[model samples]
Target: MIRGVLALIPDEFRRFTPRYLALVVLLALSQAAAYLLSVPVLQALFDGNYGDAWRWTSWLAVAVAATAVFGYLQSMVGLRIGVGMLRSVQTRLGDHLSTLPLGWFGTTGSGAISRIIVGNVREILGVFSHLLSPVLNAVLVPIVVAVGILFVDWRVSVAMLISLPLLLVVNRLANVGYSRSNQRIHDAASEANSRVVEFAQAQPVLRAFGATGAGNKALDGALRRQQKASTDAVFASVPGLMVFALCVHAVFLLLVYVVIGRATGGDLSIASAIALIAVSSRFIEPLNQAAQLSNALRSAGSAAQRINTFLAERELAEATAPVQLSEPSIVFDDVAFGYSEDEPLITGASFEVSAGTTTAIVGPSGSGKTTLLRLASRYYDVDSGSISVGGHDVRQQPSETLLGQVSLVFQDVYLFNQTIEENVRLGRPDATADEVRRAGEMARVDEIVERLPDGWATVVGEGGASLSGGERQRISIARALLKDAPIVLLDEATSALDPHSEAVVVRGIHELTRDKTVVVVAHRLSTIAHADQILFVDAGRIVERGTHDELLEQGGRYAAFWGERSRATGWHLAPSTYRSDLNGALGG
Candidate 1:
C-alpha cells in the first residue's frame, strides 16, 4: 500500500509543478514554526513565565493561519489534478472502446465496462486524494521534527525511531489483508452493476411475462452479495488498526518515561525535557495519519487493477495511410463469419452488387441476412475471405472512406435526444436546413412535421421514444436520404411502418437507389419484386438466386417462402373481404 501511494506521485505530481513546490516550502515553514512554538511554551513553563507563554501562543496562531492557506491551495490543486487525470483516462478509454471489434461488445457485458470506467475511476481518485497528501506530510514532517529532537537530545530521537519498525509491520499486515478483500468487493460490485443494467433493459419483456417481481428479487440478491463483500473488506481493516494503535501508545509512553527519568537524574534540563515531550506529541499525529491512509491506498490498488484491465483491451485496427473511395461496389468473395467460434452464422457466402444496381437478400429468421449486411458496412469483419469496396479491400480501407460510401438504415432506429432537424442532420452534419427539409419531404415525413407541435425543432426523447414507430422509421429514412451515400444497406428499414408508410418509405428508398448500389435485407416479398437480383439464404448458405419471376419458376426455397407469406397476407382476396377475414381470425 505504501508503494502504491508513492507510485502516484510521479504521474499525479508532474502537473501543478510550481504550486507543488510552493506547497512544500509552506509545509516546511509551518513545521519549523511548530517546533519553535513548542520551545517557547516549554521554556516559559520551566521558568514559570506566563507572559512569555502567551507570546509563543500568538506565534502558534500565525503558524496555523499560514498552514490553513496552504491547506486550501493543496485541496484546490488536488481537485484540478484528479479531474484532469480522469478526463485523460476517459478519452483514452473511449478511443480504445471504439477500436475494439464489435463482437467484443456482445461478449463483454456493458455493466462491467461501466463499473471499470465510472465506479472504479471514482475509487481511484478517492484513494489518491485521501492517502497521498497525508503520506507526503507524514514522511517529510517527521524527518524535520526528528532532526529537531536530536538537537535537543539524541536519546529522545532514538527512542522515537525505535517504534518505526512496529508501525511499518502493522501497516503491511493491514494492507495485505485489506487488499485481498477489496479485490473481491470491487469484482462483486461490477457484477452487480452489470446485472442491474441487464435487468432494467429486459424489464418490458419481464413485465409482459408477469415476472417483474422475480427479476427484482434476483437483482436484490446480487446487491446483497456486493454489500457482503464490501462489509467484509471494512472488517478486515480493524485488526491492523488495533496493532497500529498499540504501537503508537507504547511509543508515546516510552518517550514520556525516558524524559522524566533523565530529568530526575539531573542529566536533562527541565526546559529541554518539557520541550521534548511537546514535540513527541506533535510527531505522533502524522504517523497515525499514515496508518489511516494505508487503508485507503489498499482499496485504491484494487480499483486501479480493474481500470488497467479495461485500458488493456485491444482497440480497433486503424490505418496510418488512409485511402479515400472513388466508387462503392461491395464484393464479398467466399466470406465466412461467426460471432462465436462454435456457431457459424455465415459460411462460404459469395455475392456481388455493382455500383448502380439493387440486390435483395431474402431468408428465414437467423439465416445470416442481417449478418451479411453488417459485414458490408464493416460493423464486423468477415471471419475468412475478403470484402472490397471499389478496388481496395474493406479491411485496408480507412474508416472515413468506408463511411463516406455507406449509409445504413435498420429496423431499430436510434435518434439522439435532440431536435428533429438535428437528428436528421447527423448523416451529413453540414447539411442546410433546406436540405434537411427536402430529405424529410422525400422520406414522406412532411405529414409528421405538419402534425407535430414544434415540427423540425421539437426535441426527441432518448432513442426517439416520443415518436411513434412509423414516425421514427420515416426519420431514419430522412437521415439516409440526407447522407446520400452511394452504397445504402437497408435492413428491414420499413419493418415498423404501416402499409401506407411502408409504401412511401420503400418509394423513397427506390428513388434513392436509382443510381447507387443497394443491398437490402427485405422482410416483405412485395418490397423486392423489382429488385435486380435476389439471394435466398438458408443455414448460412445461399441456396438459390434469380429475379422474382425466375425464382417462382424455379419452385425452390424462395417459392415455398413466397407461398407461405402470400397465404398469410391473403392478398388474393378483395380488400374489404380480406379485412373481414383478418377480423374473423382475431375474433373481432
Candidate 2:
C-alpha cells in the first residue's frame, strides 16, 4: 500500500518522502522511550529511593517533550508532501490524458473516463492526509516498543515480539478476496454513473419514442449491481476483520499472562508488572488503529492501480521532425486499418482527392464511410499503407499541425454551453465580430438568430438543447465557415433535415467549401450526382470509382445502388380514400 501511494506521487514530490518517513520513525522511537521511562520511575519510587526516582522522573519528562517535538515536525513534512502530491498527480494525469490516442476515449465510454478522472483521482488525494503516516506508524511503533521493552523485561518482550509477525500473517489472511470485491464495486459504480448521465442526456429521444421509463431501466440495473457489489464487499470483509481482531486479543492475553506469572513467582516486582501492562497496551494500540483503517488503505491501492493502468496506455506516436503542408489534398495509398487487427473494416483501399476538389464516399450502412474520414484525420493509425494530407504523410507531421488543417462538420453537432457568438468563436478565437456575423450570414444562422429572443447573444444551453436540430446544425456550419481551414470533411450533413433547412445548409456547404479540399460521405443523390469523383465502398473494399455518368455507363455496383435509391425517392403515401369512397357511392 505504501508503494502504491509512492508510485502515484510525482518524482519531484518524492524527494521529501524519505525525510517525512524518517521523522515519523524518530517520533515513534521517542514515544516508545517515554513509555519505557515510566517503568524505571515507578520501580524506583516503590523501592523508596527518593533520589533515583527523581532522576528517572526528569528523564521521562525529556523523552515526552522530544516525542512532542518530533511529532510536530513529522506532520508538517507530511502536509507539505501531501499537498504537493495532490497538485502534481492531478497535473500529471491531465498532461498524460492529452497525449493519449483520441480513439481511446471512444472505446472507453464516458462513464469509465469519469470514474478515472473524478472518482479514482479523488481516491489518490486521500493517501497523504488520510492513509500514509498512520499506516506507517502502525507498522513501525510496534517494532520500536518491542525493542525498548527488551531492556526492561526480556521475558515479556519476547512474547510481544512473537505477536508482531503473527498479527501481520493474520491480517493478510483476513483481507482475502477484498481486492476483487473492491474492484467489482468500482466497476459497478462507474457503470451506474454512465447510465445516469445517459439517462439525463437522452431525455428527448427517449420521450419521443415513449420510452422515458424504459431508458431508466439501464440506470436502475446499474444501480442495483452497484448496491449488490457494496453488500458483497461488506460480507467478504467481515471474516477477515473478525479473525484479525481475535488474533490481537489473544496476543494481549498472552502478554498479560506472562507478566502475572513472573510477578507471582517472585521473579518480578509488583510495580514492574503494573508498568508492563501499560507498555503492553501501547504495543497493541497502534496495531488496532491501523487495523481499523485497512479498508481505506485497500481503497487507495485500488485507485492507484486504475490510474497507473490508464497512464500506461499507448499514445499516438508523433514525428521527431514534424513536416508542414502547403496543399490541402488527401490521399489513401492501399490503406488497411481496424480497431483490432484481425477484423479489418477497411483493407487495401486507395483513393485521392486533389486540392480544391470534392470526393464523395458512398457505401451501404456500416461499410466504413465514416471510418475513412476518421483515418484521414488520424483518429487511428492505419494497420498498413499510408494516409497523406497536403503531400505529407500524416505520421510525419505533428498531431496539432495535421488537425489544424481539417474542418469537420458531421451530422451529430456539439455546442458548448455558451452564448451563440461564443460557440462560433471557438472556430477561430481571434476572429472579429464582423467576420463571425458574415460566416453566420453565409450559413443561414442569421435567420435562427433573428427569431430567438437573445439573438446572437443567446445562450445555447448544454449541447444546444434549447434549440431545434436544424438550428444547431446551422450553428455548427457557421462555426466551420468561421474556421476556414484548407480541408473540409462532411458526414452527410443534410441527410436528416427538412427540405428548406437542407437547402439552406447546402448553400452553407457551398460557402464553406469554396476553393477548399472536401471529402464527404453522401447518401443523398443530390450531393453524390454532382461530386467530382465517387468511390463506391462495399464489404471492406472500394469496388468502383468514377463520375456519376461514368458509373451509370458501367452498370456496376454504383449503378445498381443508384437505381435502388431512385425507386425509394419516387414512392409516396397514397391519397386519403374516405371522402372519395362516400362521394362515389352517392353518385355525386
Per-prediction TM-score to the true structure, in the order listed: 0.84, 0.93
Candidate 2, residues 1-588, lDDT tens digits: the string is 657678877788788888978888888778878878888888888888879999999999999999889888878887777778777777777888887766678778878877887788777777766666677777787888888888878989889888998898788778876767998999899899888888888887878877666446777799999999999998988888888888898999999999999999998899899888878887888888787787778888888888888888998887778675778999999999877767899999999999988999998999989989988988888899999998899988887788889998888899998999999988889999999999999999899899989999999888998987788888888988999999999886676789898889889888888998999998789889999999999877999999999999999999999999999999775566766877799997
Error of 1 at 335 (Å): 3.1
TM-score of model 1 relative to the true fold?
Answer: 0.84
Give the TM-score comparing model 2 with the true structure, all chains together: 0.93
Q: How many steric overlaps does candidate 2 have? A: 1
lDDT by candidate, in order shown: 0.78, 0.86
Which one is best on lDDT? 2
Model 1 misplaced regions, further than 4 Å: 1-29, 32-40, 48-66, 124-130, 191-215, 257-271, 322-324, 340-344, 493-501, 543-560, 571-588
Candidate 2 wrongly placed segments (more than 4 Å):
44-73, 208-215, 453-457, 577-588
Tell me model 2's lDDT, rounded to 2 decimals. 0.86
